[model samples]
Target: MSTDEEKSSGSGRLLTGVAWAILLTGLWLWGRGAADGAGGASAPTTGDVAAVGRPLGVPLPPAREPLAPVGPSRVEIPSIGVSAPVVARGLDAAGAVEPPPFATPDTVGWFGTGTRPGAAGAALLVGHVDTSTEPAVFYGLSAARPGETVRVTRTDGTVAVFTIEDVRVVGRDRFDARKVYGVHRPGRAELRLITCGGTYDGKTGSYTANVVVSAYLTDARGV
Candidate 1:
């Protein structure tokens, strides 16, 4: 197969792996919740969001013109005390976006193939919510309120300032790729910070939902 075909195949597999992971996580959460007699209620099935909680719809800030592209070196969220080095990552063997290693859970992973930070597209950054023992860099990401600032330090010694527009904890089953991963405005530079959240299932070793913080570039300094 050609290189492009290989990438496509890998991406397809990655999506499959993500879906299976979500399903297995839900099942495990349900079984464990039932076994623990936590309210003596059966665990909700996959896509059964009655117990997963409602989706949040935080208002976005006004769109602005895009800035020149620049590679990111670090990400900071002063509101939640997050400061981490940013590393570029591609799909894993399973085709899902490879997150920072568990050993270095404090680091953040950027989808290097897509739009660079401060550019006219959605730049994706993902990190672990927590390791087995402690909270990761993005653990408090969901608590970020609208209008907060997310600063991305670029390799060019400039900081791209993004203002938070929305924060939502979306269940894995109901995840909408287009809405969560797509660019809202054609010429606006946006950033997405993602981490796992919601109920944790020991059996599945995964969280029931993903916390996505959406922001857009409002200003830049040292440019």
Candidate 2:
């Protein structure tokens, strides 16, 4: 429900296979050759690139009982020293979740129409890794380690505390919408923090992959 400063910025059965092929083809076109051109100033290392697609190793905790849904107002990651205001955002014309604008690069955007932070589903929060000129709110998001905590304060005066379970980079080519954005476990409240990652192509002006941090609600307060 908050406003930002002025700035600039499915399916089943055998028929699903055809849809997937088309989608994958589109991703390849949009992100092709992203891995090329090495030795650039900011090119990610081979280790960094390889780590993005690795399976999660963090142990999952016992699923917590569900809580009432609450609109998130802020997010904090103590280990990473991130504390930022949160604004609700909707899908863009491309049907992808839109992020906060460059003008307010420090703010985090929550997918308002989806699951709320403390509810029994995966609540998504996204931000920019960097703007055209400099690093943004989630610039250091990839450095966050599993087992760290992400706290979300809600408009209803509640705080949803989640524990990091996994952190992985998903290349546009290998992106799986259901896995990346779907609920990992039923009856549990989860949170996903995402931002662009992988190689940045100056020619195309876009990142070739996305960084995703997965967590689940472990505690709550002020309910």
Candidate 3:
């Protein structure tokens, strides 16, 4: 299949790409218990949220109608102090979605081929967990709890407001692509903020798992 850069106009489409499929497949190669490493300098994951998931009594707002397709320009999550520019990123040579460049550790990269931020499907926004010497834009991503707000400013000046529905530290061995990357609801516009989590492996230069934050469009407004 051709790459997003070659096949997309940033239209609305359900999350499906050879790159993403291959990506989760690769992550699935690691051992099942990789989410809890046996020996690593990696810090233990923690969060302030106390049972805020939808099943736990957190009231969620109604989903707004999916908007016309438009590229996202920025992402802001006040609960975790994330305000970063969004860049369109394509697949690497391995046919996996590429993260933002390390040179710009504070920027979030959008999968240009998949669903737009406020469109009918789930839009993916990925960021770095850390750099060589510093915490990156998504370093605090896991700290974000369910019921928080994630605002995506689109190119058309509409802000797609989403409410956090779930947060998970997905182990590489159990990387369920449909749960981690698929649409949360059939017609609701959804968003996902992903970053490295679990434990960091100095040898592999990557994390053992991923912090996946799931949210759905609850509101929409201009500016």
Candidate 4:
């Protein structure tokens, strides 16, 4: 069986990238309000977010789309102990969204262009668990289990709590975009958490499988 840490092909990269970007943008947007002061309702202050060191590499594969801001703002998952600054951007060369690393967890990234985490559709969040030099910001994410709660603190000061419904390890080739990216029921919001897991392959410089977590809105306030 392939490990969860493997690098998926086109679809995997897109799926993982999009999810991470949304979560990452949420964090960034939470800290910075819009120019017109719109959507700053409950966003987090820059002081509340964690800082980080410089990025690792030049970020291979040129960025494909222009970087865009995230929705609502601020992403907080207290259960997982993840509170950090975020930066949003559009897709890059590999067609994956990129989020900047927050200071706390060595480094964390996101997908700049994708569904917002607490939106009506399947919101995605991606993060690195670890790298060669250090433990990644989301390294503890694998511990997330079904029935667990994921709270997304939006810019409006409203909080959306999602209940973990499913968690699985899938091969990159078997990734299903429609199921993962498609919209949910009307007025209902969903979220998908993704990360590389299983085993790392030095030859490919990626992982063998992907750890995917699915969550649905259980509660929300202050939209």
Candidate 5:
């Protein structure tokens, strides 16, 4: 069965909760870096950050076989001009998908239950819009419009192109998980990109809304 998180009442509380979780992640990244001598003369590179970095061709050992020509696992939106690698991770018992690298505790990725970009079901990708000091890769996602293309590069060297269908900015308190994760009609595969958006509440420490971009897979290979 598919599991969806319940809607909340106030974005303030949700943001606060996320901030606390993200803070822990930040501390962990710092601590791990220090222990690993991240201060080395080499200077930090993309590999240093959890989900924020340049796209590389290095293969993850013991790779999961392709589920339909999964591309490079890198995503690109030509309209906004964004291209970044996406990692996949299982959800915790709490069912909360991890935040992006910039959000702290550095747990950016999607829950594995959803389909990959070119596959059958809805595929969800989550990222942080920004943090206390830096803007994230997906910060301008709310501006994407219908007809724009969202490209996914799979591990098997194929690209899946998705045409944007719509965009919405929903309050975190009212995020609708069912609508976001619900199965799609036959012949149509959906992709959802999510990121923090709207004003940031310093006191509560979270964004007022989440920017969601919905798209339908238009082109695929090896399916």
Candidate 6:
């Protein structure tokens, strides 16, 4: 691996809804609450927001056949200047997918119990938007656009090259885990990078929405 580096809450209503929507997936129980500013220290919130739906007249590459499941060891998004190590993480006591500890804000966290990157499913990775004092690894994630490339190096020594297809800042009022985290293409290998977004609310001490960057495997190569 290599270079780079970046939650929220609201009322309890947001937590319950996020938790429930994720449960419906049944593949991985990554309740948004895990990214909901758990263990937060109040850095400036992530304000970059947009949802560039697939553009017309731009043909993305076909999905490559999924490789044998293997854990990711590192990730890179050159467009956004992201290059960082990826560590396995599990569900927290709250049952939501946990992010890396606050002390290591530059590292990315993978859902250890879920689909591995380059496998035939959506592999989930998360990172902090900010800490008590500064921006974290995924601080610029929402700035990524479709057609951009995200490379994930796996334990098997393969680099999964995923082409970004969608970038959405899902608001609390419109959060949907199945739509946000579920596999977009059933047979394709997918990857999702998530973090807190929207305006930070002092009332709840969390962001008002989440930024989700969705992509699929278009190519793969040796490390």
- 56-151, model 3: which lDDT tens digit per residue? 677777888888889999999999999999998775665556667667989998877677898877677887676656678988988888789999
- Candidate 5 residue-wise lDDT, 47-121, digit = tens: 211122212553222212224624236788888868787787544455444444433423335544446666655
Winning model by lDDT: 6
The count of backbone overlaps in candidate 5 is 10
Cα shift from native, residue 49, model 6 (Å): 11
Better of 1 and 3 by TM-score: 3
Cα lDDT of model 6 by residue, 78-100, tens digit: 99999999999765555555557
Cα TM-score per model? 0.73, 0.73, 0.76, 0.60, 0.64, 0.77
Q: Over 4 Å off in model 3, which ranges?
A: 1-55
TM-score of 4: 0.60
Order of candidate numbers by lDDT, starting with the best: 6, 3, 2, 1, 5, 4
**lDDT value for model 4:** 0.49
Which residues of candidate 2, in runs, are more than 4 Å off?
Answer: 1-61, 93-95
User: Worst ten-residue run, lDDT, model 4?
Assistant: 60-69
Candidate 3 steric clashes: 0
**Tens digits of lDDT, candidate 1, 32-68:** 3221112222223335232222337745556666777
What local lDDT score does residue 133 receive in model 4, on the 0 to 100 scale? 46
Model 5 lDDT-worst window of ten: 42-51
Candidate 1: C-alpha RMSD to true structure equals 12.6
C-alpha positional error of residue 82 in candidate 2 after TM-score superposition, expressed in Å: 0.8
Q: Could you tell me how far off, in angstroms, the CA of residue 40 lies in candidate 1 after the best superposition?
A: 44
lDDT of each: 0.65, 0.65, 0.67, 0.49, 0.53, 0.69
Cα lDDT for residue 81, candidate 3:
96
